[model samples]
Target: MHRFLIPKELKILVETARRSCLKKPDLFRRGGYHRDLQEIRWLLDNVESWNAESRISSVSAYSILEAIVLFFDCLPDSLFPSQLYSTIMDASKSFKNSLEIYNCLPEINANVFVYLITFLKLVHSHSSENDTDLPLFADTFADVLIKPPAALSLSQIPKSDRDSKRKFLGYFLANDVSHLFQIDLLLTRDEYPLLARHLVRTGTN
Candidate 1:
């Protein structure tokens, strides 16, 4: 239930799908079609054994993407954190200000956010080759990244508010995150020590 640090399950899901999503143009954009609740739950329960078993390997990229989205959706606070909702959704907020806002996130949250956004940016860079649409990605991820304060319900969000939030996500997709983060996509090596620690699944975790 803690909303600060991301869990191992999420890292596993994203890492597992990283290659396929990047290489298969459709996988990153379309994600996967099998967003079944049962599958997501099954993934959550069994992600610990991912390296030891082939079960998770058989799951579609769509299900992996769905499980990742569901994980954030169920967090005590959404990825952007409720306290910054208004500031983040402000349409007039400058691109510089958005980078500042990202710095405001807790260390772990910021790292993970940068990590995920960096991946999204990479996928977007291949948009022409991958055929992924940024607007749709923005719309779908808006609810996941930003939302009404904890006191409010998603059902209560107005259309204008929704649009603003989606636009906010689009900014991250459009910009380079290296200004605020140190991200190396090739996590297979030992460089970028700080990020390498977060990307890998440790026995102690």
Candidate 2:
């Protein structure tokens, strides 16, 4: 492939979680599957080929959400790579800094990063039924998406800076990163937009 396509698996998991969690009160409290590595692998492998609209009743919200979390875990270079961690933090409270940070990322990283943020923003918007507020969502994802330091024992990342990644992520969740990522979620568009279409908007923009 000329360019690494944003993994359809991530899209599949996001879409699956979106459907599984809708209108379900305290879905996080119900808690789907997070620890079952075997099950998570199965979900990723099986649904990787399935269309975004496709769904099965057996899949639980927690399982889908956990799968998404693991998706980030599987990344060799995090959504916010360690090299740019400082730049991202500097931009945390400034729109101009956010744009600069966006420009600094690789195309694939930028697109996938935006895609994920878009999906999570949608999830947060419906937090009323799911009991997932922006802070909770941001804090939950910070560990996965934000790479603290290559070596915690080494004197690389400062202690205070290490502790504040979640606050920065919460800032992003509360603001607009869509302008950075042009992709539009299917939920906002057609009744059942394909992942391809959901992502295709980036090309047009």
Candidate 3:
């Protein structure tokens, strides 16, 4: 199994998100979810690296996952169709393949799987109502790509488990270019701070 490492493409995505955030911090403050979307795109793009064994420090993982949720909560619809979506999806798939190589680490595997599942859910939720069988597509993607564990009910997982799941899923989802192109639901405040801290740490390191 290949270990996770931040990819060059994902680094570019993060830079774009940071630029967007700098360009309009107030937009994010005033409920502009687009800025948040950019940030999520960046985090998800690099989730595999963040979840990789060598990279599995709590601070780093939390920082990346927290950014994803925060950006998700704050992003607006106008950002859809941006090129960033395609980048996120491509990166996510690449990382997912790397993760599959090292499934022995249940903690990492579980967390990454949940993050991917969440991304699929977000995609399903965000797709246009007119789009045919979007939900079915999401389920199908999860079935084939994720194969969630029977012992792991997301709701029943502890905070650490939930955090790991979110982190992994965030990376997995970012690979789906469609996520970059649509808006489903905003992330909750409860999910923000943790990810934000992760973002800060990632930036510095």
Candidate 4:
């Protein structure tokens, strides 16, 4: 198991993003901004035997990737391209181990979905701002394409039973699932233009 340390660079990025979001209250709801900031703080303050290894694990890797994507999305377009690409590449490579780790923690599926959605948003935003072609790797939905069997299996569960059990679990766990949908919606809106253009251009080719 690879030990995961919170890199100083990531810490700085999270803090900077949090500060930027906080400064622009009009751009995002207060509650959303606070939630984002709190998530970062939790990541920073928490210490567990798994903290180091979590980045390599599929379940935890998604959470880490989602946080990074969110932070990166808030950054100025003028930021160093090479640095951003290097960071994303590292995260993508690490996520390759997510399948093994995911087997150990089935409940983290929602987090994985959210992370992929966030990643899509990041790539779309990058393409839009740079007026450049979208990276091919960004074309597929990683969570859906890479883990469809797992997702389909989950979807096979009876809706009534699933809802009943989820209701009993109350707001906290329910909110986690809802967050995935929220992230999905955000990504859909963010990437629609790029996706449309890509589809049109690809069809012609």
Ranked by TM-score from best down, the candidates are 2, 1, 3, 4
Model 3 weakest lDDT span, ten residues long: 77-86
lDDT per residue as tens, model 4, 1-205: 2112223324333334333332221221112233434444354445342352332232222233344444333332211122222233223333333323332322223343334334334433444332322233232222212221223356664444323222222222212333323221122223322111110001000
Count of clashing residue pairs in every prediction: 1, 1, 23, 3
The candidate maximizing TM-score is 2
Across 1-205, the per-residue lDDT of candidate 2 in tens digits comes to 1122365566666666666666666644444443343454554554534633254335566656665666675565577777777777666666556667767766666666677777778876887766777777766677778775576544766666644666666656777865665443323222222222211111000
Query: lDDT values of the candidates?
Result: 0.59, 0.59, 0.33, 0.30
For each of the candidates, the C-alpha root-mean-square deviation to the true structure, in angstroms, is: 7.9, 8.9, 18.7, 19.2
Model 3 misplaced stretches (Cα beyond 4 Å): 1-66, 69-102, 129-197, 201-205
- Identify the superior model by TM-score, candidate 1 or candidate 4: 1
Model 3: how far residue 163 lies from native, Å: 28
Residue 114, candidate 4: C-alpha displacement in angstroms: 2.6
Give the clashing pairs for model 4: 4-52, 4-53, 58-98
Per-residue CA lDDT of model 1 for 66-162, tens digit only, reads 5556555665566677889878877425666776777677666676776677666666666776666778677767787776787877677666887
Alpha-carbon TM-score of each model against the true structure:
0.71, 0.72, 0.22, 0.21
Tell me how far the alpha carbon of residue 94 in candidate 1 is from the true structure, in angstroms, after superposition: 1.8
Name the lDDT value of residue 156 in candidate 4.
61
lDDT preference between candidates 2 and 4, better one: 2
